[model samples]
Target: MEFNSLGVLMIITIIILILFIMMKKIKNNDSDTSKKLFTAFEERMGLTCDVIDLKEEIYGIGLDRSSNTIIYLNFVNGVEQCIGLSEFKGVYVHRVEQNKRSFGKSKEITEFVFIKLLPKSDLAGQISLELFNHKWYPFSMEELELINKWKRIIEENLS
Candidate 1:
C-alpha cells in the first residue's frame, strides 16, 4: 500500500512541473512576438533611417513602449525619430528578386526619400521636416509625398 501511495505522489509532482514549464514557454513566446512586430512597424513606416553608425545593435538611444506600440528612439541630425512596427490587413505581402540593367547607360538611379518605414502623418507626434540636401538637389515633391503617405497611415492606426 505504501509503494502505491509513493507512485501516485510522484506522478502528481511530475504533472505539476510539466504544467509550470508550459506556462513559462507561452509567456516567453508572447514577448518575442511583440518585439518582432514592433521591428516590422519601423520598416513599414519607411523612417528616413540610414545607418549613420555601426554598433552592436540598432538604435543608439534607449527604447521604450509608447502609448500604442514600442518605439526605438534615435537622434540623428538633432531630432528623434521613433522607430517601431505598424500593421496591415487584408493585403498580400510579397518578396521579389530584381537585377539592374546589364549596361550602366540604360538604367537611371535616383536619390530620394524612402518613406516606407516612417510613421503615418505626423501621427506619432508633430514633427517638422528638416531639409537635408543630397547630390546638390533640394528635397523634391516626390519625396514629400512619400513622407505624407506614411504619416497618414500612422495617424489612422493610432486612432
Candidate 2:
C-alpha cells in the first residue's frame, strides 16, 4: 500500500471532522436531558420559573416567583432528587481556595464559590451548589448573584 502526503492529510482531516461531529452530538444529548429535567421540575412545582443554572445531568437551580421558592434538582447515578425550598434553616455563601504547584512551576491559586443549603430538618444534610463560568470554569459572578437573589427571596418568605 502506497500512501502520499495528501492521502495522510485527508485521513487526518476526516478523523477530525468525525470527532467534531460526535462531540456536537454528545453536547446536544446533554442539552436535551437538561431540558427534559427542567420541564419535569416545572410541572411538579406547578409554577413557571427561570432556570438559573443547569449542569447537564448533574444538577439545576431554578427560581419560582409565584411561590417564592428555590427549586434544586439533582441527578446522581440515575437517581433524581428534587428539593423545593420555600423555607430553610439558612443560606450561606463561602469561598474555597486551593494552592497547587506542578513540576517546579509557581503555585497556582484556584477559587470556588460554594452556595450551601441548610435544611431545617435534622434528617437532611446540607447541600452545596457550585457556580461556574460559561466555559465551565469555576466561580461565575453572574451565577453568584442569581443565587444570592434567590436566597434573599426564600429568606423573606420564611420570615
Candidate 3:
C-alpha cells in the first residue's frame, strides 16, 4: 500500500493550516503577555506616570488626567515632568489596541509597538530607536527610559 499524491498533499495542507493557526495564537499571546508585564509595571509604579492605553478611552478627563492629551506625554524630557502625579489623574486606560497585522490573534509577542516624543537627554544623552524591539517604527529613548525606570520601580517597590 503506497501513499497517494492527493493524500500526501492533503496532509501537508492540514499541517500547514494548523501550524499557521498555532503560530498566530502564540504571537498574539506573546504581545499580550508583554503588555501584561508592562501593565503590572504601570500599576506598581502607581499614578506617577501616565498609563496611556489607546485601546481604552484615548480621550481622557482633562481636569485630572491630562490638560491636553496624554499621548503627547512621550516627550524628550521623559515621563517625569514637573506636572506631578498627585495633582494629575490621567487620560490613559488599561488596554491599548494592536495596530500591526500578524498571524496570531490572541498572542502577545513581546510588546512590539511603542511611540516616543523625544530622546532621554540625561540617561545616555541620546535615545536610539533600538531601545525598542528594533521595530520599523521609531521609538524615542525617553520612552524606553521611562519603561525601564518603571520596571525598576516595580521590582524595587513590589519585591
Residue lDDT tens for model 1, 1-159:
999999999999999999999989997775555445445545565433332211112222222324333233222333445534453211111112233577564543344332233334454542323222244344456645544544454444442
Q: Estimate each model's TM-score.
A: 0.33, 0.62, 0.37
Poorly placed runs, candidate 3 (over 4 Å) = 1-3, 48-159
- Overlapping backbone residue pairs in candidate 2 total 0
RMSD of 2: 5.2
User: How far off is model 1, as Cα RMSD?
Assistant: 16.7
- The lDDT leader among the candidates is 2
Candidate 1 Cα deviation (angstroms), residue 25: 1.1
Candidate 3, residues 1-159, lDDT tens digits: the string is 256988999999999999999999997776565445444444443432344321111111111143222222222223322222232222111222355656755633344433222322334222111123323344455645655553333223221
Error of 3 at 151 (Å): 22
